[model samples]
Target chain A: MKHAVSHIIPNLTTLTASQTLFDMVPLFREIYAFRDLLWILVGKNIKIRYKRSALGFLWTFLNPVFMIIIYSIFLKILLSFDARDPLFLQRLVTGILVWQFLAMCVGDSLHAVLGNASLVKKTSFPRIILPLSTVLANFVNFAITLPILVVFLFVNGTTLGDMWLLPLVIASQFALCLGVSLILSCMNVFFRDTEHLMSAVMLAWFFLSPIIYPFSKIPEAFQRLALLNPMCGIVTAYRTAFLGTDLMAPRLVVISLLMSWLILALGVSLFQRWQVNFGDKL
Target chain B: MTTPAPIIDVRNVSKRFSLQQQRGETTIKAIVVDALRGHGKRRDFWALRDVNVAVQQGETVGIIGSNGAGKSTLLSLISQTSQPTSGTITTRGKVSSLLELGAGFHPDLTGRENVFLYGAIMGLSHRQMAERFDQIVAFAELAEWIDEPVKHYSSGMYVRLAFSVAVEVDPDILIIDEVLAVGDASFQRKCIARIDAFKQAGKTLLVVSHDLNTVHTISDQLILMEKGQIIATGDPDAVVAQYQWLSRETACTAETKEWGTGAVKIKAARFLDAEGQEAEELQRGMPVRIEIGYEASRRIDAPVFGFSIQTTSGILVYGNNTQIEEFDLPFIEGKGTITLDFSALELLAGAYLFSFSVHSQDHQTNYHRLDNGHPITVRSERRYEGVCHMPVRWSVGKGK
Candidate 1:
């Protein structure tokens, strides 16, 4: 026997298993309601990454500085890459920082969902928050270290050209990282081989993107194909904004922005599919 | 029909978990292998059947069954972690499962920090958790250790703090699996009291426990399942009773039937269902037997062996002895099992105690007596609210 229920049905909190996603409205709302959870996870990432170390939070600033020093020596001194160029160290610093932010997000995401298997298997929070938190954590770290970049720029005496375009490019790179992170994180959940494969992929991807080398160095015929990487456009835009290198055409940056969001949309849909059985996979 | 919309409505939902997925095998190898094999060869194990249940806004639904009965799977489905392979589950408001107690907890974080982080995972904003922070700390009784990292806390302390943080989130719909069974006895009692208050406040609840008595006493409706299929779901008493009987037929899992003393000490006792097979439970209005095993130290004269079924509260439902039944008992010795058969037991659906005794016929001496205090579960299909089900019919004649 059932009673004639008189309760009103409010919108937005209803969930149907048949289609948990694809309709982004409620997904966005769920994510919004759990924004506090997202922030906490991001905080956890930032804190736990350097826990138990003597130079804990200092590592965030020191890490990039050291990488810049090591790679500059390995590249310009050892490999003699554009050794005569006076501003080569500045270029390397700016390029490495941009690359490191993206790398942290996508790289961390490989373990984002897998490492938190307990969370994924037990609770039903917005799962995107996992990969998204990695992206945000790296973003926050990057934001906190902007002063380091600014300090470097001032020390080098280089004028930041079309400085406003910097935020747009940074935002573009965040989207690219988030999209790829989602894909890699979900893939890693079902296939541990993705971890090995992702490391290899990220290694190759580092070279594929123009972090140390200028984008113009790529053969002229391949430049059009390289723009499709999204990161190429991003890295180029960042160097152009900071070092005042020939600013990559506005149209190319626009193409990368569109590509970034498109990949993000693809990531969301694929994540929905992969995540359906995440508890089992994890 | 004005059917009041239940806050949680699960309709014909089923979930199939892939074996390959559990083994961490992914698409790339499977894709290439499947192409070479000329077909899809992956296997899926169905974890749930067509389970359909609806719970009104304030109803408490208790799920009980043996291991691998898909109880947790159903909870996960309703809680929104794992999606169903087929069918739809719709729930209103936030559904937080205690199954994920302390989920996302970092061992390096202090107990206080873990609380907010754990709270945040359950949908509590930092400000909201901060508002309840002091209360949570006091409830966990971990004030001294709150600032210490969770890794330093004992496992019991970890669970205590986690349970405290979860209770404070106070979602509209709560899912708990063996949560009340956690912590020490005193902590468990505290959790039960808190859960009772939550039930009193009219929150929709789905609770799962192997402890049948607790679930039976607390739930309005009970679900019994076997092999991912619902065997029964209805009034708590009747469903619980049926689960006992069904479990007897399915598995040999029964309580080592509890307290008694005497010369004719009831070494052990068992109940037989209508089919005359040993079971942990008996069906109401069905023929059953209570078999008592005893080992007498020496020969006893004119000993009266008897049994009494009483309400758990000590009210007598029925009692019978060999002398009362006009059977004269001779001297008894050695180990043996004696059975008392009932054509049909009419007790209502509730736990009742069985008291077995053997004494001198004149009541002058006691040879042996065993009141194991093991409550026998009598299941019923009808919802008769009392200690016994009376055979009565209503007639609407003029004389009536």
Candidate 2:
């Protein structure tokens, strides 16, 4: 009797034996449907940052200011180069602010999925929100600190021109940080060593970028290879917008933009492939 | 007109997990070497295999099984917390699962903030959650601590708040896995009543529970699973009977060794009905007779014959001895039968093990003892929510 009844119930829900490349699109659409969840998580991340702090949101501005003072003292006063040039201070502040944003985003993203193992195991939502929210939280921090950059630029007597282009540069940097964050976060879920590796890599990437030192300081021979680092083009564009430096090389900006999109595609694809196994792995 | 589809249609679903034996394999060097060699040892085990279940709208289906029976795996698959390795699960409604209470709660966040955060995680908008926020807090009875961080709330308060938010979302299908086992008894009763109301409002419910009575009472249909397979699926009483019989058989087979000094011995033990006919299963809240046959090789003074009814987990539900009951047995030399009769066995629907023993007056020396001697399967006529059913009456009226 049981066998007869079992046979009568048709298998209406059938899963494919294997996944195809086209499956990526539907997975993205699923994540898109849960965008509101991403925003809530981002809000949670930002709220927790200042939850118990005494200075609260002021720390966001104070952090960049402190880093600028320390770097300027060490690089300009001790090293005794360009101590009076306002452009040097303007360049350093803008570069540090952007670099701090990327560092925090990457550092936090490394633990995004691993840190939320409880939620991943018990709840059903878009898993990508875990990493995306971490990136966005850092983005909110960067926005909070932007006023400090404006104050520094104003104090240095620097004026902005064609400021509309600034959003493009910021957008490219956002995409770049988000892409790298996605890859690191997803990989960290499997290989916990990825987080430590990222800290070291971010340190090296920071010094290699023109954050503390001017891009022109690097000998012209290594300039092309330096531009290969997406942050190089992004920081150069920020300097061009604020300090009125020469425009970034068109080829370098294009290369950075292409790299951002490519990394995003790669990160997303890798994330989707490993996500089905995340619940069990965690 | 076309027939409406079931709220959840799970077809031939199976989930397999690969167990990594080598801790070294997690390291980069080991993984690199294994990849280069193109060979890695993988041991995979299936938690569920080809399990088929369809939950129509307004149906409450309970899944009951022993530990490691893939009950949670089935629930996880249905809830979409985890995907099956094979087959497909099609859910046609907003499915909310309370797989674990306070699963996504942030300890640092206040209860009010967590409500919005959890609501958003469950796909409710900030505006929608704001509208339901008061209702959720009121239902949880946690208005006093709603602004305090969840870390300060007791475990019971945490569960109450989490359960309130989950149920208040008004999901079309609700999948719960043993979350009601927490909280105080009154709160549990309230949660169960809320679930009952959900059923009345035509919501599909898939519940997994080790509490046999709760499942038997709540589920319109029951699915009995064993070792990743659905062994039986039908009426709650009949399925529970099958589960009890199987559990008893397995328990008895594992403990076959018996030891005694043989001054006095329990020869046989069996359950009997009112007509004195041998019966392996009895209806709950009905008369039950456990007849124990014994013999004595030599004369013994004041021998105490007793029996205990225990769930398979060895929880002593009820037990009684002739000596404790003050039924003085003077002496015994030869074959005799000890009869224990209960007017109504108040056991809920489940399997129970019967252990019969004979001991001397001081209860220090055991003449003979049979552990897990027999199994009694009880089929309850009415739904209950605990280990044993208590006879009671209910009245409802407005207090003037």
Q: Quick one: best lDDT, which candidate?
A: 2
TM (chain A) per model:
0.89, 0.86
Clashing pairs in 1: A4-B2, A4-B4, A5-B3, A5-B4, B259-B372, B263-B368
Give the per-residue lDDT digits (tens) of candidate 1, residues B311-400: 644567788999989888677888888888888899877566777888888887776665534567776677667778778899887774
In order, the TM-score of chain B in each prediction is: 0.66, 0.80
State residue A243's C-alpha deviation in candidate 1, in Å. Answer: 1.2
The DockQ of each candidate is 0.33, 0.27
The residue-by-residue lDDT of candidate 2 on A1-282, one tens digit each, is 333222222223233324432366766655666766788788888877888899987777788888777876887678765656546766777888889888998888877888777678877777878988999999988988877777767765679744666888888888888888888887887787887788788889989999977788878999888777888888888888777784766777678666776777788778867776677777
Please state the interface RMSD for every predicted structure, separated by commas.
4.5, 7.2
User: Which fraction of the native contacts appears in each prediction?
Assistant: 0.59, 0.35
DockQ versus reference, model 1:
0.33
C-alpha TM-scores of all predictions: 0.77, 0.85
Task: Choose the strongest candidate by TM-score.
Answer: 2
lDDT of 1 by residue, A225-251 (tens): 888888788878888888788567788
The positional error of residue A253 in candidate 1, measured at the CA in angstroms, is 4.6
